[model samples]
Target: MAPRFTVRYFVRAADAAEAKARALDIALEQTVEIPRDVVPKGYVEDEILGRLETLEQAPDGRPGFLATISYSEDDVGGDFLQFLNIVFGNSSIKPGLKVEDIGLSPGILSLCKGPRHGITGLRARAGIGDIPLLMSAIKPVGLSTAALARLAHDFALGGMHYVKDDHGLVDQRTAPFSERLKACVEAVGEANAKSGGRTSFVPNITGPADAILERAKEAEAAGAGAVMIAPALAGYDVARMLAADPDFSLPIVAHPAFSGANVVSPDCGFSHRAFYGVLHRLMGADAVVFPNFGGRFGFTREECRSIAEACAVEMGGPKAGVPAPGGGVNFARVPEMRAVYGKDVMYLVGGALLQEPNLIDGCRRLAEAVYA
Candidate 1:
């Protein structure tokens, strides 16, 4: 038998028998996608069909049962998307099923390069030890390249360890990607020269598939310290390609722009940790951004903490990633964030800083609060 990977899921049902039935149904629906009896007798049944390993009551006692299913690595065909498809592809559309955890085989790990910079490398790049790294986005779009560059400069000058383009800022006439990339990189460079800080400018590179690699290369040549991409929009494999490429050495920050639907439900799709933490880390995200608790996005405190834990938790060989909790984060929440995430996190503050009368001063104060 070939080496296989395991996926644990919460299967909602009234009884153990029903849960077991549903688990078996998933093994069929996720794989061959046809009637089990009609499945071929040879390789299809022996190698392709998912094997149910266990079916028992859920640990949380949430009116569901825990089901562990194992799949042959051959079924994944050494492809990332196929691996994802095997994990939760067809079954995701059905209700009362949530992916709780994934156990990757060595073959799966070999298929991914994981995080290139990761947490330690990113910390080293920022020249900060164990303290929580500071990051903010330059935004509201519609800003000219020069205007955005000025914001990037101010952010770096004000001591933000990393400055990034807002996810919404793309190749618009107001600020073309190339022009914004060049100007912001230069602006941050100038600020670093004056402040003697190793602040990095991270530009969003999410765009047409053909344009992503070119933009990433351009961003590197333009002196960007890191690059950001919304994997949910650009494609998860694209992020994996950049992370795996030796030429693109800059850190890749994974933004959770269109991934909310994957984790919003209690009994469907993916768990917060699986979608935002483990999966992104596997795809080579140095830092994974998600909506914070108490933010407008409605993520629960437990859900947010679980994501942070997943990023830093031991997962065989993948480098630990930084969990960046943003989306409505503010200066006032620094103490609370510190208490929650400790020093290994990247505090992402955006619009809150823009609300201050002086953007530079607001960022400085924000930095002080974080490092203090």
Candidate 2:
């Protein structure tokens, strides 16, 4: 047997046959020297199979792993995040750890369904190949279905390719998710029919575990183009489950709602790229939405860029996802935003556009700034 390099994931993930098959078939054996103390006592075959191997130690005292895991081709059955969950979603949250060597298995690689609709596919779908896709959101959840749908109609008519419900828009008594979803879908469709444009309506479906999937299914059934969810709000596993569900095929847009606690601690939690980038992609999000630089939330320019890079970067299976740089991106920032995000990005400008003197004109200027 030949020695091979390995990498291990630490988070709680889906440990299914596909993951196991990927590990066995894809990874090659590799020799590594782990610290004497880290390996737990009574190691069994169960532990060795789909277990994290040890390698060198980190300066921070995190035990490194000599990983022997690889993605199976069959593993491409679900969302990218789920793929990662199965690999290392749990381990990332654990206390002691360091990624050791990386092992690639042919099985998982063969099955990996790289981005089904990556930046290129998204642009094609939006009918804007040479420029970034334009997106907006309807928010302040108290609004009725008609009110939100009217906004959706205007945005679609104004040349926005995607219009999603604010992650906050849940199934409130005032504006139930289903009714709002149906109304918005119809509104966008009506606008597209007149304009002959491909406007996609993405409704927020963030809810409890029991209701989340039902909401997603309903949104899809209502002719919605995509469904949005705050994975952290519902459960990190929720996105993966929806992605894997055969009938729930609409692209999932992952939002970082309620996940602020994890990244606030620099030393304890995962790096921003690891969470917003790697983990979100693995969860099966075709497009991962995050707060952009110069936004109210205070994400730095570099951080925003990293998030964008993560969405486009090459992964084990498909091309990376669309980096939806949202949160206070405005018409004025279009030139600067375009310079950073490039044409293969999704420009999400919301509240600012709504506050503008003319919502339609503001959108046009924003689009021009990006396309120009």
Q: Pick the candidate with the highest TM-score.
A: 1
What's model 1's TM-score? 0.98
Compared with the true structure, the alpha-carbon lDDT of candidate 2 equals: 0.67
User: RMSD in angstroms, all models?
Assistant: 1.0, 7.6
lDDT (10s digit) by residue, model 2, range 254-292: 888887765545333555676787667656677888888
Which regions of candidate 1 fall more than 4 Å away from where they truly are?
Answer: none
Clashing residue pairs in candidate 1 are none
For model 2, the superposed segments whose C-alpha errors exceed 4 Å read 1-114
lDDT (C-alpha, whole model) for all candidates: 0.91, 0.67
Candidate 1: count the clashes: 0
On residues 194-240, what C-alpha lDDT tens digit does candidate 1 reach at each position? 99999999999977879899899889988999999998888879889
Worst 10 residues of 1 by lDDT: 330-339
